[model samples]
Target: MGSSNTSFRQGFILVGFSDFPHWSSFFSVLISVFYSLTLFGNSAIIILSQLDARLQTPMYFFLCYLSFLDLCYTTNIVPQLLINLQGHDRTISYGGCVAQLFLFLALGSTESVLLVVMAFDRYVAVCRPLHYTTIMHPLLCLSLAIASWVGGFNNPLFQTSLMMVMPLCGYQLNHFFCEMPILLKFTCEDTGGTEAKMFVARVVILVFPVTLILGSYTNVAQAMLKTKSMAGCKKALGTCGSHFVVVSNFYGAAIYTYLQPQGSYSESKGKFVSLFYTIITPMLNPLIYTLRNKDVKRAVWKVLGRGTDSG
Candidate 1:
């Protein structure tokens, strides 16, 4: 216990992208741009969803949650990452690393569950249009949103507790952030059982939600097939398609990172993959949703028009 506490106080060196010394500036610039865009894009979604009366449906309500999650998700890691990339000292305190791990896992897990909830919303709107309002009432929407948050935050507690107790052999973390697989590499004991347990948790968090989203979409596709109105079909496609695109981007990167065996993991590849889901995807989400969303565009124009008139 004394040794563990001492090690925790000593902190770990984040050996971020130090290998590619020449590319540090490039990565720094890239990460800064992406982080800025993530802040701007997600904030727009949240503000638009709240301010525009038309954007207050179950879908937009869920979207507002997603945007907020993305904002927090990126903010948690990106600043530390930029500092490491730009500065010579690349160390994170034990407490900071633990907090990062917990927040990252919680926010990420919340998104997986939230995506399923969003898919279900789409499914109900398309398959049971008449009952959509009653089914996805304000109370239900609020409950589902809260449930996503609760589930997301809970999974991380178990994972982070398990991680912090392990005896580490060294303090040099070979990635940009305090991720599970990378941290496991430093454990002094044989972690086969621990790895297995984490694998199960990952499946529960990542794979289970994916299965639900797919099932929801499958039902949505069947309902779309039966609909006769072209306009209705087009509208459904627009809304559902944007969501599916976001899902593909998010889940594809996440599954590739978490679902694989640790032995096969490459630090170089893992860092880039982390960048994808962490930085790039968050930056792209608002763009993905707003580009296809007519309502958001109208809201943007309405706000802009008001500003123009006032000016």
Candidate 2:
């Protein structure tokens, strides 16, 4: 009888596999190259920021922290994705899957929190220019940074703990990674109450940070408008542009995934957008900030000792 039960559990449906994106060889190469570039570019930014004493301002400090987050954020998903693409059908063990869910949740949440903190940094820098240093001093920045990580960790810990307690019997996960919503869809047990509980968790973990970001940006716009000089306003707008672009992409994708009704989970389209946040955004972040800002360029060159004219 025990053997029969074991065999039945073993025969459970495996809805997921290690096989990666279904693409031609050419497309595979293109994706591989893109992932490599993302890793290299983000690492360089972190290194450059750390070595350059000139980049010790609040802005660059947050940027360095962001680079670190991007590195972690992409690392959570991309490497596994690449392995799967190589025809490995990467079968993450049950424990491994749980760990991935935990880390991914933590890092992703932390990043959202960090983005809000950055918005606050910009608000202080622009709206309270006279007291910017006082408001965004080093100690305060460190504290905020630490708080984001703690908040990130606590969110996943609570959610995952709740999930683990519920019995998972026959269902297999469908997506490449262990996204909370996708995982929730597969449980054979009653998940209605679990789903509601998770929804409340989402509201607390995600909605509050989003509200903070919106409030900060609102203040920033008001501050920018009140500036006496047109040049000052223009410069402030330019400085905020990259942050705005990143904020839009990150929050837009996240809102669709987490904030939507349960029935709205479109497997195909949602997976594609999830890729944007999990893979593409991290790569584009450094590029967006560096290309648009002259200060970062000067600092990068100073640290690396390279120039446009010559090697």
Minimal lDDT window, size 10, model 1: 302-311
Model 1, 1-311: lDDT tens per residue? 33544447688899899889999999999889899999999999999888888888999999999999999999999988998998667988899889999999999999999999999999999989899999999999999999999999888888898998888766789899999889887777787888888888889998998899999988988878888889988988987998999999999988898889888988899998998999999999999999867788888887877432222
Model 1 residue 143 CA deviation (Å) reads 0.4
| Global Cα RMSD, each model | 2.6, 3.6
Off by over 4 Å in 2: 1-27, 169-171, 304-311
lDDT for each of the candidates? 0.89, 0.76
Candidate 1, superposed: residue stretches over 4 Å from native: 1-7, 306-311
- Candidate 2 clashing pairs? 18-89, 18-90, 19-89
- Predicted candidate 2 versus true structure: per-residue lDDT over 21-98, tens digit per residue: 356355457667777878888888777777766667888888888888888878877676666556555466666667
Q: What's the TM-score of every candidate structure?
A: 0.95, 0.89
